[model samples]
Target: MALRESPESPTPRRPVSPAPVELASPAPTRHGTAALVSAAAGVLLAVLWSFEFVDSVIGDTVANNLLGHDAKATAIGGTGAGLLFAFVSGFAGTFTACNIAMVASVGPLSQAGASNRLRHHLRSLLRPVGWLALGMVAVSATYGAVGVLIGDGLPQLSTDTVGGMPVRLIQSSVVFGVIGLVLALLGLSALGLVPDVFARRPVARVVLIGALIGGFLIGRPYPLFNKLFHWAVETGNPVYGAAAFTLQSLGNIVIVTLLFVVVVLVTRGGFLRWMTDPARSALVTGTLLVALGVFTVVYWDLRVPSIFGVGWFPTMPYN
Candidate 1:
């Protein structure tokens, strides 16, 4: 009986199911990398426009039309008229080379928190703008007081030329170069390529940006600002100069405010919510900072130097 059990009892094995194959969806497009690339594209656009023809086309035509060429500052000269002129001129010249970059400021305001309640929502929208003005007023007003007190003594306001290059332009090169570098770094910070100083320090970053925009006057070569400056000096009232410059900076930011209003209205208050998304916020902020930063540097440092034979950059046929 024991010997009978040996015949056909082969070992039975359980069927092994193949491990589930994971079909990984393609990786999502990285917002950070995309943002960085966008910044580079913006710089390329600016570089392409570095030719003299861009001056003829965009600068002369669009900027001149907006800035109202031949409208003398002296013509706009009463006490009220002068201040009015300063503001209006600033508003008109928003598209000018020195100031257009300021549009990038909207990027920082994107950090503002959103509210569903209408009254609170509007306040939230405007709060950042006010913070920006705090820093702007400090710089613009202080510079105005100092600028008028000095009255053409600053090398930036000088009318002389060296090696066929305007001395004021040289000053422009230096000032803009530094600011441009700062802006580029800010962009990197936004993209998290650099230390994310701005993440925990929103107010400070905004204030810094506001200060930079306010400082634009320090390097301005605009004919209107020059005229206003001379008129300010003629009056010999630093208070008047400070008031005028402060109004000017206010006018510049007014356009930004209006654009914000339009955007919020158009999006039905959705843009603010859109900005809450970390990836989108980083994309927007990083792109703008890098673009304008690089433009400021390349235009003032490279393009301008090339104009006076200091170095060479590519020029278009129309240029």
Candidate 2:
């Protein structure tokens, strides 16, 4: 207790002000720019896939491998044949522009997946898929039934053309346009650039995505689907249509589902946790949504329209 010790009660130190959060963060800018570029790349990829060289080669090749060369003839044998065709065709379409966007679901699925003991993880895998299938089945069954009743009256099955553009292609443009916008917006939302509509509504989101997958049939122009449509009409049975379409939707999801399972099994659910982690979830989910979403929009709307001179998409030399 020296007198010196009491002489100067040290002046209270000023609390340091936390470093200024740059009011204008570069983060948003970087994200926005990356998003734009990703979107552009999506469009380009859509164009590439649209070109005859790529589309005909990949889509047709896949279909041939899956259903043999008789895509149209193969479905004509009877109800069993038609149903089988519906499924095989849907499955084969996994790479086509109309259906490829379905792949975007992988992002949400990955984000939703949770890790646990392998037994629990394996069992848990199907829950999200079941939810997805529920959504898909509803749309597909309804559309299939109604499509039979409506026949060519449905724009998706129209034989008519407008302004020299096949009405079927026009339907593709409209349907995929909406779906793509939805996916892209979802990506933006995940990236924190928009309201998080599905943050608390994860189940609904999955269902909606499933519904979108089902909706793919609404715009699908594959030969087998077209064949199935006519078959359902000829049979005069909505039940047939509904059943076949449900199967088709289920088939459409089979490969992607398997891939999801493989990822979970191989990684022991770690990939999903890594993806869904708060830090990386948004980035991964957003990128997938934006890319696939933009691909859907461009492949259908822009690329298809270009054929009618509504716009121009680059053509590869081989085509």
Candidate 3:
């Protein structure tokens, strides 16, 4: 009995375990990410397209007419033409050549599981983009100044206005040719499927040469470029303008496609991972893009009044 009782006596013991550690997680992707990117991209495209139109038309006119008749004046009027040339030369030229930026800023938010990689890509592109932006502004400013000057003077676009035959003639002819080339190239480039080596590197050279050639073509028959210009301006319908803008933006879409590849290469995993977690991805993407859209409006509000000397858009000011 005693032995059985002793053997039966056993003690109850508890097992110990370590506490789980918590980590800070990224925000979830909400459903609105794609919409936000699309919207923001649309706005950006609109702004860029407006400038491009000006650049394509005006730059061609001025550079072409630098040795010819005052076709630039006839084609676009005075300040309008100046603005146009400025748009093409400054905004048009670079905008088409360098839209990888949108992808840099937005691709991470759009793609899945690639936030960190996207960020790195963006960082790599930042310097180039900033330089491009700065160059665009400078070129735009120069184009504007020249346009304004010529607008006031109504200088006959030819070698005499630009310089001598050796340098000026060659330069002017080259400019016209180049612009024509860019317009033609733009038609194809707008498809946006070109390889990066071609897209990023070759485009600038192409545009430079094309600008000269295109400028010559448009200058030769200022009436032709003007017809398109007239169509664009005669229509007060903002929708038509917007449509035109959208059509023009097809180039941007192509440019963006090229950049998208770069973004994909750069932002490898984070974006995809984020995409898997749609909730947080949407939230981040939506919030940032919406903010960017709002900022665009605000920027337009501040900029238009100062530049245009009026307040036309209180609602959708940027458009």
Candidate 4:
């Protein structure tokens, strides 16, 4: 016999519906991506500028080597010569391995944005670039003062007989070779051709990288810079040393700004998107750097002309 249904009879209930899966939002648009990249680029630039500026103060080697004139002599020759030397050295330094790497690294950062009209794109870059410049100047001044203190406190080394000409030439060649190797590795990494260990970009550790570059400049004393430093130290005027280096740094700033502006303008046209591509940009940058390194070694180190006398690389007239 069927049992009578109880008031609270157990009954099969309808199946419970499964919870809906939530979807992630779509990836950021190119414009949004560009904006984010630009912001990051600005921060990177600020950090690099700050560190390099300090390094400039600490070393001043590149300035002295490239200028090939005593700061005092220039000052006596006329403020014009001093200023010109400062500007020339600063501008020329931008082409060095570390500096060129800095420039190439920015390409990926700038590529994220939408292609605006050339005028508008440049306008957008101006503010960030201006901030970068200001950061450099501010940091340079602070560090320049510190450099002066260090210069005054340290026992001066005699430049007159530091080494024979042959020894110095060999030393310079070895230094350039090492720098060329470093640049070559950097270029390969930028191209993504190297192992992941070496391919790390500049975004996260830019400060550290900049510091390393600065340290390198400081530790390696070239003949010209050594001579200049000796002259400044003998005078017993830290101001002269500080001013000379500071002016040189300012010269670098001017060229760097101009170059950056040109990059922004050229890239804005979108004709060079390959330059901004994560992989491709690396390739191009790496190629250029490798070429630069090779050229430095062959031309500057060997003191040889390019094939067919083409003058593919620049050689310092003073050298």
Give the top-scoring candidate (TM-score). 2
lDDT of 2 at 4: 55
Stretches > 4 Å off in candidate 4? 1-85, 92-171, 197-200, 204-231, 234-243, 266-274, 297-319
Candidate 4 C-alpha lDDT tens digits along 1-319: 9898797999879999999998754322432343334334433332233323433543345555656754323442444554465455555555442344334324323332223344566555554444444444444444444555566343223223223333333444465556556655555455444553434433322232232233223323333334444444444455655565555455544554566567667766463344444555544445544454444445334442221242453333222
Could you estimate the TM-score for every candidate? 0.82, 0.87, 0.29, 0.47
Candidate 2 C-alpha lDDT tens digits along 203-307: 677788899999988888766567777888778788999988998898889889999889877987777667656646667777778989998887788778987
The lDDT of model 2 is 0.78
- Candidate with more favorable, higher TM-score: 3 or 4: 4
Question: Could you list the CA RMSD of all candidates, in the order they appear?
Answer: 5.9, 4.2, 18.1, 12.4
Deviation from native of the Cα of residue 192 in model 3, angstroms: 33
Off by over 4 Å in 3: 1-247, 266-270, 308-319
Ranking by TM-score: 2, 1, 4, 3
Best by lDDT: 2
Worst 10 residues of 2 by lDDT: 50-59
183-264 per-residue lDDT for model 1 (tens digits): 8788878877768877877768788888988988887776767767777777889998899999888877888888987897
Candidate 2 regions exceeding 4 Å error are: 1-27, 51-56, 64-69, 115-119
Candidate 1 — which pairs collide?
Answer: none
Better of 1 and 4 by TM-score: 1
Off by over 4 Å in 1: 1-32, 50-69, 73-76, 113-119
